[model samples]
Target: MIQDITTSIRTTVVLWLLTALIYPLLILVIGQGIFPAQANGSLIVNDQGQVIGSTLIGQAFSSEEYFWSRPSAVDYSIGEAAAPTGLSGATNLAPSNPDLLALTEERAEILQAANIAPTADLLYSSGSGLDPHISPASAIAQIDRIAAVRNLSLDDLQTLITQNTEGRFLGIFGEPAVNTVTLNLSLDQR
Candidate 1:
């Protein structure tokens, strides 16, 4: 019985080392070696080399000069106010919910006032509320406003949109998306 107990304890220790320490360390080494950018949170930097934000997460852009990201339930607070609540989730509001309806209507009105078409993406927040990508149509709808605000030509804005548009995943899964964070950074560069 003592020998059996010793064997079980040794097995547990070995398993714990393999699963908790060795496996994670191996994965970290592999990830850092092969996919450093992605493994490092896909962070974006500015011209001065200051880390701005991550392409994996969305940010709130309220200025008319820049294209807006998807509506965030948490307002894309990031490390500001949302730090306490953790990150990335939906409001889980049902379609029939009155608050959701009011919010949607308000968003639609804002788009209409701007003379921009209220596409589905513009009117509703994404499921994660942290999506950094907006639909191509949504991007296009706001081009005129951005061009007018930035004093840029419509053609140039259109070209920028085309350049920043991302292709569908694996050429089949998921729809094509435009990364708003990258797009905004590119605009700043230009």
Candidate 2:
């Protein structure tokens, strides 16, 4: 019995050492070297060089002059930088779901108040609650409101949106999207 206990302890020590120290250290070094930006959380900085947020996560914006990001269910309460809980999902509530119906009505009311057209992206949240981009249609839906609020012409805002819109991964894997952080930063510059 003692011999078996001693052997188990030795195996545990070896496994723990490898898992808790050596393997993590090796992965960190490799990750830092190969994917520095992602390793650093894909942070976004401003002209003042202040770190605003990460390009990988979405933030809520309620104003009219800025382009809004997707609805984030995370709420950033536990900690803004913490890995969001899996519960932070887009309700997945169907159109007929009472909660979804209420939310859609509220969103539609907001769009009407802003004199803007509503899009599907604006009405729902993404699965991860951390999408950093909006569909081009969603962005375009808000152009009139943003333009009117910023006192900029619709044509100019459209140009800005066009410039900020990014194509798919190597033109195939993912859909095109506009980065809300970049778009809002550009608005601040203007």
Candidate 3:
């Protein structure tokens, strides 16, 4: 019937406007007004005020002087040619997969070569492949290497780690983690 068709079209338009435009605009205004830094990617800046990176994403740090982040399946490429297609996610390789085993072994070998024992977070890429935080244990495990490379005392480095460690959400949720990006930046300052 014509009435039914008219009602249906009107309902569709109202719902579309609410979801596709008005709702998102409301959220944007609220976000920008309430949390401007987080609304704009939570970017970290250097002493010169250049945008170095975002706190929400991980970056690869191969330097022995810095604490490393979790291994990323995408190698932390956002739009680079290395990972032009996607930004995050696991390799999805099963534990029994030969490629997974080989990669794990290779990571283990690299850690052993550096005299640093590999932790779970170091050996395996996180599910998102973009986790910026590493386990407290992982950060502690690298203190000796970082201290040696940076010519800083081990006790000083340990203190820095303690200072930078972020506690769990509401003191109950996820495990404590250290933001490697922030930790490295703090090291640079020191």
RMSD of each: 1.6, 3.9, 1.9
Scored against the true structure, residue 168 in model 3 reaches a CA lDDT of 92
For each candidate, what TM-score against the reference? 0.93, 0.77, 0.91
lDDT of each: 0.90, 0.81, 0.90
Q: Against the true structure, candidate 1 has what lDDT?
A: 0.90
Q: How far is candidate 1 from the true structure (C-alpha RMSD, Å)?
A: 1.6
Pitting candidate 2 against candidate 3, the one with the higher TM-score is: 3
Candidate 1 lDDT tens digits, 118-189: 999888889988889999999999999999999999999989988989999889988888889889988989
Model 2: ten consecutive residues of lowest lDDT: 76-85
Candidate 2 regions exceeding 4 Å error are 1-22, 76-87, 92-96
**Candidate achieving the largest lDDT:** 1
Off by over 4 Å in 1: 78-80, 84-86
Clashes of each: 0, 0, 0
